[model samples]
Structure formats: C-alpha cells, structure tokens
Target chain A: MKQTQALNLQQKTIKALGVNTSDAKVSLSYLSVAFLTLLIGGILGLVQGLERAGLMELPPWINYYQVLTAHGILLLLVFSTTFTIGYQYANLSHALGGLLPKVRKFAWTGFILMVIGVVLAVTMVVLNEASVLYTFYPPLAAHPVFYIGLVFVVLGIFACCIGVFINYRHWRKNHPGQTTPLLAFFAMGVFVLWFFASIGVTVEVLTLIPWSMGIVETTNVMVGRTLFWWFGHSLVNIWYLVATSAWYVIVPKIIGGRHFNEKLIRLVVILLVILNIPGGFHHQIIDPGISESIKFLHVFMSLSIAVPSLMTAFAMFAVLERAGRRKGGKGLLGWIGKLPWGDVRFLAPMIAMIAFIPGGAGGIVNTSNQMNQVIHNTLWVVGHFHVTVGMSVVMTFFGICYWLIPYLAKRKLTPQMNRLGVIQTIIWTVGMILMAGSQHLAGLLGDPRRTSYTTYGDHPTALSWVPYEYVMGIGATLLLLGVIIQVYAVINMMFFAPKGKTAFPVSEPEDGAPSAPMWTERWGLWVVLLLMVVAMAYVVPIVDMIVNAPPGSPPIRTW
Target chain B: MKQFLYGLVLYLFLLLPPVAALLESIMIIHMHMQMPLLILSGFLMARLIQLKFPDFFRKWNSNGVPGIMLFSIILVYWMIPRTMDEALTIEASELFKFISLPFLAGVPLRDSWKKISSAGKNSVFIIFIILFSLMGWLYIAADEQICNNYLRVDQITLGWGYVTMAVCMAIYVIQLIFGDHSEYK
Candidate 1:
C-alpha cells in the first residue's frame, strides 16, 4: 500500500511537470489528420464556390456534386471528428492525470478505423460511384462500400466514446465523491451525445447498405431522411458543446478571470444534453409524413434549447464584465475596452460567440414552420450553417489550435505565429461574412442550394443572382487563403516552434463561490432522463413514418 | 409550500380544456405524456401533504410496502386498454383518471420511494419492466384496435413507448447493480 501511494505521487508529479509524451503523440496524430483534411476540404470548397459563381468549370470526370460530397465529408465528418477526439482525449489525459493504457489503445484503434473508413468512403466519391452528398439521403444511394465505410466510422466513434467513458469511470472510482474536472465533464457530454446520435445514422446506413447491395429492393425515403437529421442535427450541437467547453474553461484563464458559477455551467451542460436530440425535429419541420400538430409541438421542443443558450450568453457577459472591472476600467462600457482584444486566443472565440447571436436568431427563424417555408432549401439555409458551424464552432477550434498544438508539441507559441493566427482569424471572419451574407441574400431572392450554376435560359431573375454568386466566389478564395495560413501556423507550432513548455489554461471558479452540487454527478440519472426525452420526442412520428410509409424508392445514382 | 404551488399550477394547466384536448388528441400523448405529467405534479405536491398528514402516512405505510402496492395497483389498472377507452368516453372514468393518477399513484410513490429498501425498489422496477414488455407485445401484436378512440398505428406507437420506457428502466437497474454507490457516497 505504501509503495502504491508513493508510485501514485510520482506519477502525479510527472503529469504536472509536462505533457506525457505518449498521450501527446496520440493527440498530435489526430490533430495532424484534422489539419490535413482541412487543407483538402478547403480546396474543394473553393472549387465548388467558384464553379457555382461560373468563374471556373469542373472537368468532365469531376462533377459539382462529387466535389460537394468530398468537401462536406472531409471537413464536416473527418476534420471535425478527428479534432474533437484529439482535443477531448488531451483534456481527459490532463484532467484525469493520464488515460489508462487500455483507453489509449482504444484511441489508437479508433484512429486506424476512422482512417480506413475515410479512405473507402472518399475513394467511392472520387470515383463518382457515390455522390449522394454528405447527408446521404435516399433514394440517392451511394455505393455499398460507402455505407460500409460509414459503419466503420461509426464504430470508430464508438471506440472513442467507450474510451472516454472508461477513463471517466476510472477517475470517478478513484476520486469518489468529488466532481469531475470541468473539461472532462464536457468531454463526457460530447461523447455521450455522439454515441446516441450515431445510433440513428448507423441504423440508417445499415439499411442503406442492404438496399444498395440489391439485397433489399427498395428503402423508406421518409424514414431515411428522418433518421439522418436525427443524427445530423445533434452532431451540430456536439460541436457547439465542444466550443462552449473552451469558452467556459480556457477563455476565462486566458483573460485572467475566474469561470462563472459552477452550478449554472453544469446546469447548462445538462440541459443541453437532455434537450439537444429532440431539436432535430425542427430540421424536419418542412418534411412530410409528419402531422401539422406534431410539427407545432416540435417547434416548442426545439425552442426549449434557447433557454440554456440564453443562460450561457448571460453567464459569459457577466464573466467578461467582472474580469474587465478588475483591471481598473471605469464607466458603463469601458470594461470591454480592457479586454485583451489583440490576443488571437481571445479574439477568435470572442468573435465566434458574437457570431452565435445572429446564428442562433437565424436558427429560431428556421425552426418556425411558417418561416422555414420561405427558405427551406435555399442558399439561406446554407448561409445559416456557415455562420453557425463555420464561424461559431470552427473559429473556436482554430483559436484552440494556437495553444493546444504548441502545448502538445512542448513548444513555445512564438509571437510571429500569434500575429499570423490573428490575421488568419480576421481573414476567415471577413470571408465567412461576405460569403454567408451573400448566400442569405441570394436565398431570399429564391436562389436554390445544392444545385450547379444554371442560367434558366438567361432569365432575368436568374441573371440578378449572379452578383451575389460572384461575391461568394471571392469570399471562398479568401477563405482558402485563411485555411492555408492556419495550416501553416499549426505545422510550425507542432514541429518547428522553439522547444519549450506551455501551460494548459483551465480557469478556477470565483473565490468563495459555492461548490457544484452532488446531484450534477449523477450521470446515470441524466442518461435515463435523456433517453426518456428522446422516447417522448421520437416514438410517435417514427411509428407513423414506418406504419404509413409510401412505396419505397429504389437506389438511384443521380450523378 | 412553494412546491405545492408549482404543483397546483401544473395540475391546473393540465386541466385546461385546450391543453387536455391537445394532449389527448394523440393516443401516446394522452396515455404516456399527460398521464405521467399528472403523476409528476402529484409527486411534487406530495411534500406538502406529507407534512400535513405525517401520521396518516406513518400509521399505514410505516413499512412502505402498503403505499407502493397501492401505487402499483393504480398504475396497473390505468395501463389496461379498457380503462383508457373508458376514461376518454365516460365522464366518471375521466374524472377518476384525473383524481387517481396523481393522488393515488403519484402521492404514494413519493411517500414510499425513500422508505423502501434497495431490493424493494429494484423489485418495483423489475415488475414494471416485465409488465410493460408484456403490454408492449400485446399492443403491437393485436390484430384489432384495442382502444376505441385510438388508431392501430397509435396503438403500435404506444407499444413502442412502453418498450422504450421498459428498456430505460432496465438500464437503470443494470447500472444500479453494477454501480458501487457506497464508494461514491
């Protein structure tokens, strides 16, 4: 027992002194894959944008849909998933004093599985055998290999989820009666949501596999769409939750202020976890095979998410104001001026949070049944995601990279790199505003999304949209440049930055603040409540879709 | 008192004509959502009642088994398809539903839950899981509409609801079995 205690003390000292080389290797590998995918996806995004604006034409072999599919899958699925795993695993290791050996094995296994899956899926897209787009909605079926690849991806996610869960349980067992570190808690929320969310899409993909293989003659289109959105919408919230983790934990430390009330933060995380999956119905507000009354009920359910979001917004402002006041700033808004605006770590996520104001408001507009009718399949919907995912989520991720990459690589964050990151953030922000803004305007003017550029025989209305399309092309060009700079900064930080130690920034709670309540630790209870809410939201409509399903659609390769 | 007031507000809101009609418009909402919410309201209100009539509960439910048995009976009676049909069509049956679910099942549940042993609580969960799975099978497999007011599809939906709830309870039970709460506590 004495030897075990001594060994544990030694281990803790080692962890506190520097990054564990093994754990750093795991995270750095994932980050490497994430940035590489970003580079490829960024190029594809520019190509698609330029093509849509009629500034460039694709060759005969590579169609617009093919490029679109590859871009969405690479950036949305591969890049984001890899980065999240990398970051969350690093958090787990830091907070829990390093992952169990088995958990690290799980991480590496997940990485291999995901890489294999991406290769298979991307090969299908590149060969033009699968151009169903990232949503992969039927009857536009992909190659059976594509669906098989997705299954592997889901399995990979499950591996990571299991790893996180095991590490959490081990920590809880050892600590006993203590609340988990805040970052670990957020990691748990992300993985739990990821696990449940993937279930719906996994089911969808499995059925699609058989159908695409001609083992099944046809598939239920409505059910397929419903299941896809069930996963798709929750995936957005998962990214949002990850961003908020950084906002709540890292940003406060960077700004030299304490985090907000622990209870309120935990409450927000809990509420988000319970309420997020049901909001998927709002994505289907305009889809058929659902009753008007049900859709109306779902509007309320979706809007329920706004409660926690408002709470977050309020908490963030309070923290900022309190921090600014401590710096001896006077007057009503002078406190804002006291903030470190020049710090890319603060600026990127700060702008991301600001973008959420419009992003969230636009979300409300989309959730409303009547409002959704006006912009359902338009470029406005595209614009909305660009603001939310691109600015709010991805920007936060970029900010994280500046510190996280250097910390893992045991390197100094050079001032030059910091300046470049700020520049990249500015360029990315301006590019997104220009691109997403024009998309919104064009959509309001009835410009459709997911369509190749067409003149409709040079109709006046079609010709009028050309200006907005050109702005989008220019914005895309700038965004690609921003991506290049970001990738370069990340590479330099990882390999070429001067060797040194960097601290992981996790903010303390306010002095004399009340401790988080024990009830928040009851994860089993929370899971049950989440399941009950999901059952309440999904059972009726899913049953209706299956029982009253239309004649199933056969697989079609539109591309 | 605050809990009682909130509960009263919930109970009154549930009693509102439009709210009642809207919830009952769908079969699963009527049986699963509305009924469970009524029980929750009563659960919330039970604190005030327990304070007021401490001896009344103590005398009859000292061992908790009596109160829990009453709760189980009330829940099982309501789970019957005929009871739901009658509650929809018959005035007295509907009134009984509004009275019995909250006052009978919900109140007793709150009173007994803490008093019961871990084994007793697990038994309750086990019983419910078994009962719900059986009901789910019956509802999903039935050739004819079991309830007059609800469609066959609605019945199947309700079956799935039962199955899902049962699954949730099963999970809770499994966690309880595996989770060493003593370590955390």
Candidate 2:
C-alpha cells in the first residue's frame, strides 16, 4: 500500500491548476454506456459468427441474430454516435473556456434518452418479440415499440447535435481570434451537417410515428421513402466525418507534425456535408416507382464524392511522410520504419485504413445501380461496413479515447491501459478481418443478412453457409474477450488507479502555439440549422414523387 | 414505323421494373401507413434494401455531414410517400415512366459521395468512377437492354447497379495500386 502511494504520488501534479471543463463527467458517462454497448456488440458478433456456421449447440451464443441486431443498433447507432460525440464535446469544452448550458443540458438529456431507447429496443428484440435489427425497412416490421424506441433514439441524436452546436458556439465566443481546432471544426461541421441531416429523418419519424401507429389511413409511401433515404444515406456520411476528423487530428499528432493544408480539410468537410444530401436516390436503384434519370444522377454524384477522400488521403500522408523524414528516418520508405508501431494512436488507425480495401469493394458493389443483383442484402455487404466503419472509425475512436483519456483526466493512465490498447487493437484487427471475411463468404453462400434462425443442430442444408459462419463465430469470440479486457482496464483506472489521480483538476493544453477556443458559437448553430432547411428543401421533391406517382399508370415507359 | 416499334419494345422493358420494384416499395411504404400494407411492403422493401440499396448507380454519403443527411433521408423518405407528391407532376411521372432515364445524377450510387469524402483516401478513386459511369451510359445508349431489365428493377437496370459497382471497385483497385499514403511510395 505504501509503495502504491509512492507510485501514485509520482503521477499527481498539484501545483498546476487543471483545465475547467465538463469533459470528465460527460465523457465518462458516455464511455460507460458505449463500453457496455461495445461488449454487447462483441458478444452478439460472436453469436452471429457462430450461428452463421450453424454452430449453436457448440456455443449458446450461436443462433443470435436478435442479439446481433441488438448489438449493431446499439454499437453503430447508440454507442458510436454518442461516445464519439461525447469525446468531441469534452474536447471542445476544454478548448473553449467553459460549457454552454443549452448544449450541456441537451447533451445529457440525449445520453439518458439514448440509454432508455437502447433498453427498449434491445429488450423487445431480445424477447424475440421484435427482431427487425438496426434497419426498420418496413415490410419486415418489428413491434411498434421498436419503431418508437428508435424514434426516441433519434431524438437523443438530435439532442447531441444541440450539444455540438453549443460547443461550437462556446469555441467561437471564448476564442474570437483563433481558428477552430481542426478536430473541433470537423466535429462542428459534421454536427451541423447532422442537425440538417437529421431534419429529414425527424420529418419522417414525426410523419412515420403517427402513420406507423395507424393514425393515417392513406399515408403517402413516396414521402416516407424520400425522407427515409435522405436521412439514411447521410447517416453513413456522419460516420465518415467522424473517421476523417479522427484521421486529421489524431493521425497527424501521432506522426509529430501539425496539419498543413487545414483549409482543404475544412473544405472537404463542407463539400462533403452539402454534396451528401443531393445524392441519396442511390437506394432506389432497383425500385421501379422512381425515375431512372434520378438514379443516374445519384450514381454520378455517388462516384463524384470520392475526390475529397482521395485528396485527404494524399494530403495527410504527405504530412506523415514529412514527419517521418524529419524524425531521421532514412531512405524514401525508411520513414515508415521510424513510425511508432506500439503506440495505439499510430498503430490502430493504420490498421483501420488498411482494412478499407474490402470495405471500398463492398461499398462499390452495394451502391452500383446494376451490380446489386450479384450481392444485395448479402453477408458481403455487412462485412464491407464492418471494415470501413467499424474498424476504421470505431477502432480509431477507441485509439483516440485511449490517447486522450489521460490528458482529459490530468493523470497518466495505468500502464496496463497501454497493454490493453495493444491487446484490444490486435483483437479488433484480427476479429474484424475474420468476421468480415466470413460474412462476405456467407453472403456468397446465400446466407441471409438479418435472419433470426440460422442455427440448427442436425441439419446442414438448412444452414447452407455453416462452414463460413464458424469463422465469424470465432471472430466474435475474440472481440468479446478483447472488449472484456478493455472494460476491466477502464474499471481499474476509474476505481483503483491509486488515490489522488481521480480528483486531479483538469488543465488546458500547454502546447503554447497560441491556444484558442475550439469552435465558434454562431457558426455551428447557423450552419447546422441552415442545412436543416436545405435538407427539407432537398427531400420534399423526392417524397412528392413517391406519394403522387400516378398509380397503375405503368410509369409511362417510352424507352 | 420501325422507330416506333423499337421505342415500344424498350418502353415495355422499362415498364416491368417500375411495376415490380415500385409495387414492392409501395407495399413497404403503405404498410408503415398501417398494418395491412406493412405485411406486404415490409417483406418487399427489406428485399429491396438488401437486394437494391447498394446499387452502383445509387448515391452514397458514408462521410460526415453528407452521410448523416443521406442516412436520415432514407428513414424519413420511407415514412411518407406523400412528401414526394409535391415534387412530381403527373406528366413528369409519366415522362419518368415513359423514358428510362437515370435518376439523381444518373447513377444509383450517389451515396458514394459520403463514403468517398468520409474515407478520406477514396478521393483519387473517384476519377475512375466517373469514367465508368460515362462508359455505362454510352453502352446503354448504344444497345444492350437485354439483361438490363432482368436486372431491371422497377424502372432501373439491375445490370446498371452491377456495372456501377464494378466501376467503384475499379477505382478502389487503382487507388490501392497508386494511392497509398505510405512512405513506401
């Protein structure tokens, strides 16, 4: 105990005042929920993996799509959405002088509502009373409560945007002259984009709830589809934004250089936000009700957005290369050798980026107007995003959180935290690769994407994809173990990382390159709100086509 | 007479998808309006989203704000078909049905915008994607409406979706070959 105290004493800094921010309270809470959500997602992932192979009898978790669905919704929608936002909020609060009341309250409320919504959604699905999974694409409807729960979840998401807006306002107000933290700017841009992005869905949900509840007898199907796709397609964009912000802020710092082309990054954010809304008609590829011209337009737009991504990739790597050479790395490629491999910040994101090859492949297949027949709703698609979003975004998020927690808490994390990072990252990498790979193969074998029953004890034909499914099961198991290890590390740090570490006051960053508030109060508010109007404007016509398509008119095919 | 016959056959091919995918879409949308339609459309749109949402000609936005907007739009659009009513005139709908033209910038993968922007590295791959879309249009304009309708979804070609996917993959491959941010370059 005495020795522990001495080590603990070494970690504390009493003379310097800690930064004043709400990051601690809010981030910790968000992590608590997200951590649980991650573990649950991992467990269900394991079950889904095994079940895909028809290996339920070998493990209780097989035959668990209900569990898997619950996991995806919670992790993808509830956890990733809020956890990353919480981190952004905390970082912004510190970057600015203090928190905004409107934003803070709204964020907290959103967190609680998200928790409640998750409970409602997971509970109903767990009972097998409702197993629609993360997507509520109608004809395969779940209980009304499931839809209601999701709407509440969306409300929580809206609240998070409000918080993001406030953070932006706080940044601008406190540091009038400073450029927004690249991360903060990116965060604000995405949040603002989301604020507008969410409106279409809000309209859909507002319209859907009453109609879904049977309030209107002849509700327009066109309106619902137009609105839903507008929101649905953009949500993936939100994930991209988060991933980009992580890359810009975290990746550069790890490589030991400040961002060079900040303006382009900012422009990328803006272009991505605005351009995303006009291109949502991609989902209607196979549908006959809408115009082919619209599909063509969306397809072109879909392909067009790849420009900024390539630009960012090139710019970021250029900086990274410079950083490597500056650090005395030899030869053209010797800089790669000098990079910090063990560092979570350096290693995790690299893995995430590498995994995207298949991810991109899956995206192209799914988004193409014609190629959908070869692999629509297949396991291949599921595997694709798991690599792109889950590994690239979620894993990098974990890395960022691990890197930032010590700074936020104003103390060193247990060295064990570093060890856990290595372990979890490896697990995430291997597990994701295996799991995603298996799912792709399974989809090829015609294994259904959201089925509740794929695990039979005696029959292999019923589970045609059983051979491929086992690989996924094993992947899930590894992820579960990895997440559990991480949770324990968090617990140990929160509760038992010696004394005096927990209560240490927060401190502003001392990089001394002229620090300023993270965001502008007015800009984020105006931008997101303005975009919301645009979202509605953009979505209205699409909906109109669906609702008023002259019924039974055979779409006037002149060919 | 020859031109009219050719146009008539093309129109017939185009009409099948709008009828099938549209009816399915309608079933999904109508069901949300109440339970009766839900039974049919729920089964149908689920099939479509799984079967169709990833169409290469479809739009994408798996990036930041665009992604959020794109995702939310899907949920919102699915709720009220009437929201779309104001956007389309009866004549426009007929014109849409009569002539098999691409929608939303001429491809199904408009959603790729968000993804490209979000991925931060997929940008270089976009150039190839544009070329692919152009080539697809050229091919369609020339001839080959055969499997086009078999892949014909509602009014869109299922084959088009596959081609668009191929384009995206091709770009990805090109990026993989040349666009590595690694110091190895």
lDDT by residue (B35-84, candidate 2, tens digit) is 22222232222323324555422333334335434333443342233423
Candidate 1 lDDT, A1-559, residue by residue in tens:
5644753774677567678788889999999999999999999999999999999999997899999999999998999999999999998888878878899999999999999999999999998999989999899988999999999999999999999999898878777668899999999989988988899999999999999999999999988988888889999999999999999999999998999999999999999988888888888887867999889878998999999999999999999998999997799999999999989999999999999999999999999999999998899999999999999999999999989999999998998999999999999999999999999999989899998988789999999999999999999999999999999999999999999989999999999999888778777877898899889888989999999888999999766
lDDT, residue A268, candidate 2: 76
The lowest-lDDT stretch of 10 consecutive residues in candidate 1 chain B is: B176-185
Residue pairs of candidate 1 with colliding backbone atoms: none
- Two-chain complex of model 2, DockQ on C-alpha atoms against the true structure: 0.02
Measured against the true structure, the TM-scores of the candidates, in listed sequence, are 0.98, 0.66
lDDT of 2 by residue, A96-168 (tens): 5445667778888988888787788777787665655565544344565776777788888888887876666
State, as a TM-score between 0 and 1, how close model 1 is to the true structure. Answer: 0.98
- Least well predicted 10-residue stretch by lDDT in candidate 2 chain A: A550-559
- Model 1 iRMS (Å) reads 1.9
Give the B-chain TM-score of model 1. Answer: 0.97
